[model samples]
Target: MMETGQVRDFAVGIEDSAIEDLRRRLAHARLPEKETVEDWDQGIPLAYVEELTAYWRDEYDMRRVGTVLSQWPNHLIAIDGLDIHFLHIRSPEADATPLVMTHGWPGSVLEFADVIGPLTDPVAHGGKAEDAFHLVLPSLPGYGFSGKPEAPGWSVLKIAMAWRALMAALGYERFCAQGGDWGSAVTIAIGALAGENIDGDPCRGIHSNMVWVTPPDEVMANPTEEEQAGLDRIAWYRTKDHGYSTQQSTRPQTLGYALADSPVGQMAWIVEKFHGWSDCGGHPENVYSRDRLLDNVMLYWLTNSAASSARLYWESFNSGEMPQIHMPMGGSIFPKDILTPSRRWAEKTFRNIVYWNRLEQGGHFAAMERAELFVEELRAWQRAATG
Candidate 1:
């Protein structure tokens, strides 16, 4: 029996046996022969996967996820019949603004680990008390420690509404939203549905690292240098890197069997994204350590959430029409993201553009790869939105 809407304390507690089982699976992982190509064009090279698997099995600290996340107060609250897990960290500053940040696929709550302190306790992290935020970091349903959706229809919009319920249950009347990757899609949905009141609660604004918008034919006909670069990136992704998305969106269950059964399979599936999407300079290790990467992979491997998480793609990948958002919205466009929409293109959907900037460095995993910049962008957006 579960109590709906009750905010109960939750701690990550993976059994010792689960840890042993993961190592055993890694030990017996059956790998294929190395790729013929020297580069990642054929997919993540066999050698790199072998190297990562060895480190994961022999050297990586299995308890790192618990250790890193234990600093925050974790909680679980039932939202729309599913138990949602989140870290609700209040700032020491009395006037801190309430902000809900979401993480996307291939990313977990761990993505914000480095920036949590800076965002919640700005004074301690070389910022003013006014910049502090009461942060709510939720693990998307079916990912990490959150309960999986037993039925379909848990689309981005549904998740957005559930987040509203989650925040209202926490006593927040109004809050801002931020996200990247699929988190960006969720944040966009939140902004679209902001008018709906959860006991007078509303999402006041949104900031996203990944902005998705369709440019007008006129703009595409004669794109500026930066716009053209963004277009080229999109084209490249569609041609070279969209297979995983196609598989997940259309046939996640089939892909999930392998990912759920093999730890190395799960690791490689995600690590390739970290490599391709981040500003890693051709190697994922350029931006993230092996342990950090494993921390995210462990979330999926331990929970056996490969198929469940991928179902989100099937549910919302072609989310038909983009809703018009008139509320204050901000975007931080990173150079190396899969989709880099310029301000002109984004203005098509986001009517009230409060703040927009093109970052010099970073990629899809902004918070994880560039913590300082990600935090600063949020703070800057907060000032612009509320100022």
Candidate 2:
């Protein structure tokens, strides 16, 4: 393990040979026969995969994605025996608050690329300087350029500790945390670990788009119509949409062999989620452009993170314990997201609910689907946290 305090500049520098190899793999991909069902009920349509893979091979620009990442200020620092990769962009304001935003599985720091400039330079984006934040975007361990954890135990709690160590290494003694998906769980854990229970609380507050609020049986014993609806969604997910989760949690390594070898297979695995999870009407292209979607896929493919990233589920999915968080909390409920717990349910776990919103649009990948709204949501949550 490298020294904890060491931070060095980093960049996305995939060589031309790697890019060529990706194209070659896409060109020679052996796909399955068309699904008998015409709709996505079975899975991603064969036609769509064929078209997407064709575009990826012939027209999509890999270099552009690299350029976008290169333009951002990035670094790598060791924490808990992993060389965690992150983007650290400072606000021009002398007293700007430091804010760390985490990304989840099937997502990357790319989700927040558009919000970085706006968050770090609020004035340029038509916000007050006081709203500025020195943004920190860390690629989760084993995802993107971050080194894979060599051993087990890099659960949400451990990642939260790593985030704190990261912030301290970067000279931030106090900061706020924001996230959605796995990022949300990590952010909540930070708040839970704060104060007298753990290390001194470096986290001032937390905001999440996908918060965990596992209400007790009594709360669910007589569910409201809305609560029942939320419960129904969860049930539906476990019944229909949870195959991937079950596989990832129990046998990620087995699935990884195929994902790591077949570019088309990897693309199909991830692209299906964006279609199912996003509010992209009927097609993923309704929200994400071809390049934008492919860029995220490239992060996972290039890093060969299929098994390592899925191992996160193996570590935490069945832990059956929710950390208690008493810090100021904010949540945005996107109607189309995979899970949107009722505020009543959320409040049971997030004790101090300072801000909550049921946004009219957006979905699971809200940052990418609704960048402007995501920014406003963060700013609103920040105000509630700071004030």
| Top candidate (lDDT) | 1
Clashing pairs in 1: none
In candidate 2 the C-alpha lDDT for residue 62 amounts to: 73
* Poorest lDDT segment (10 consecutive residues) of candidate 2: 193-202
Alpha-carbon runs more than 4 Å astray in model 2: 1-3, 195-200
Clashes of 1: 0
Q: In candidate 2, residue 302 scores what lDDT?
A: 84
User: Global lDDT for candidate 2?
Assistant: 0.87
lDDT of 2 at 181: 89
Please give the CA lDDT of all the candidate structures: 0.91, 0.87
Q: Show pairs that collide, candidate 2.
A: none
TM-score for every candidate vs. truth? 0.97, 0.96
The alpha-carbon lDDT assigned to residue 309 of candidate 1 equals 94
lDDT of 1 by residue, 207-282 (tens): 9999977776856999988899999999999999999999999999999999999999999999999999999999
lDDT of 2 by residue, 1-387 (tens): 124859999877888898889988998888889999879998999999999999989998877667778878889998867899999999999888899999998999998878888888999999989889999999998898999998899998889888988888899989999998899989988898874333357788899988777856755898888778778878877787889999999999999999999988888899999988888899999999999889999889988999999999998887777755788889998877877887888877877889999888888888889988998998898898888
